[model samples]
Target: MAGDSSFDQDKNKLAEYETSSSGSYKSSRGCFNSKTGELMGRNFFSWIKLLSFFFIFCGVMSTLFGLCMGIFFQTLDYYIPKLKIEDSMIGSNPGLGYRPAGGLGFKTINGDYKGLSIYSSLIWFRHGGDGNFDRLRENLDKFLEEYEPGFFANQGASLTKCDFESKPKLTDESCEFNKEWLSDQGADIKCISAEHYGYYYGKPCILIKLNRIYDWFPDPYDINEVRNHSTMPLSLKNDIEKIYEEKCDDDPNKYCPYLNMVWLHCDGEDDPDKENLGLVSYTPFRGFPGYFFPYRNQRGYLSPVVMVQLKNPTPAVLMNLECTAWARNIRHNRLKREGLVHFELLMD
Candidate 1:
């Protein structure tokens, strides 16, 4: 009987140990599942972070390439300036207007050719009318006294009357004007058309009278936009014509022809000897880019410019002037426009 009791006790202890072991195993399994879920969540976040970094890297690379292309094209456009004479801003204004004369504006960042004098000193003059060798010398003299030593003056068309009359032949009106102007000056300034009648440098010369200079070169402070923008003289076009006719009738000996029509330039230009050429109005001024940028427009801030007006700034009336003494020859004059003569400077 004692042995049977001992066996029963042993069986009970074994059952208790088995139950405890089972519970412990269940708890361990639950803990393992929770750990696995946390690991999965962390892996998802890592994948998301990796994808975001990849996208950011691609965006940065694309921006860099775009910037590089922009710079490359901008630089290329500046150096390779393709100039078209017909589309030039300077020569675009037609027969009778105050078109901007195109020349180099020397900015004095550190050297000479600065301020108002620089602007005023830089100008080019055109030569027109039939060649009366005597009158030619007078014009040359005037140019020397008024302009820089390096100024270039080119002779356009033979000294003559209206070259572009409605019928294209030189008109009687032009002839009469030249005769009168020469008579008034007591010097010959005749103009007779040659086989060809055109601009001096593949461009047309503005053929306004000497008396009309004030209209174009007015004070910048003047609020008159018409005077500022006008290329025509200040009087009625027909009224002035009548006056000219009346003057011719009254004093036959005191008449001057009107050759005040500027030409529109185009291709097929011949460069005058640089030594003889006065100014560079061959090409037009294309502002900052391919836009019309007038210096002192009523709209925006006026761009600083150099204006050089030569009004009777001569040494003496009876002085001998060398043709090349005070003029600059650009690309054309450096090789062409090189000739010498005596001239004077006289303008009111």
Candidate 2:
């Protein structure tokens, strides 16, 4: 009986050992599964990071390529001159009076006469009855009383209604309107008169003149660093020296800034030479809001003319309006048609 009891106890011991081994197997299996999940998560994150990096690289390359293409196209268009009709000559200054230096004038030898039609041309005009001061005062008074003040205030724009009431003093000395603040708006100093016109006898005439000395040949470079290197590309820093050597530099006078000036004049019978004409300035002849003038000429005619000059004289045409053969011929031909007074363009 004692031997049987001992065998049963050994069997019980073997069963306990088996149970402990099963628990350890489960714990090991769980640890292995957890490790596998962590590895998978790490792989997912790494793949996402790699994909984002690839997209970023592609975007950067695309931006660079786009910029390069834009620059190349711009350079091509700029270097190559487009064929444009010589409408500039036809649309230049009010026809009459004197031609300013480095100026262009438009003369209408034959055309239907209408003040509204003349206004349609690119010319600047301030009526002859009052000068800039009086006009400004009149306009300011009307503007203040009109809807402009309320409209500006509602839009959060700040402006003094009274500042321009009498004629604002010149804030900048370089501005012509400022220089003539106290005196007649036409006097003092301002931009060179590119064109002016008045009537002599009964013949309506137009004249173009330069208001300032060498106003046409203005500097192109806005910055000191890039001023001398206008022809060279800004991107190709290393190759700039070579580029400049290959391409000719910009000429201030030769650059035609898509500007044209013309003048128109009409006077009553009496003596044509005794007419006093007003000057007009027309800018950006094409599209909307064309032409503006603030002063009158010595002739007794209303002068509506266009004034054109380049902000940057790079493409070279603004220097001397006479430099252009077609332009010069047009002026000469138009002026000669007038019976009493004829214009001969002589370079000074």
The most accurate candidate by TM-score is: 2
lDDT of 1 at 298: 20
TM-score for model 1? 0.18
Question: Mind giving the per-residue lDDT tens digits that candidate 1 earns over 24-122?
Answer: 433654232242342323455776898899999999999999999998777654422343224543322212111122222355777643222222212
Would you list the C-alpha lDDT of every candidate in the order shown? Answer: 0.27, 0.28
lDDT of 2 by residue, 1-348 (tens): 999999998889546545664454345542322423423234557768988999999999999999999987776544222322234332332223332211122335675222222122222223233321222223223322322223323322222222111343222111111111212234222222211121111111223222211111212221223335443333222232233334434543432222222212222123222122212222312101101122221111112222222121112111112111111112323344321122222111
The CA lDDT at 164 in model 1 is 16
What's the lDDT for candidate 1? 0.27
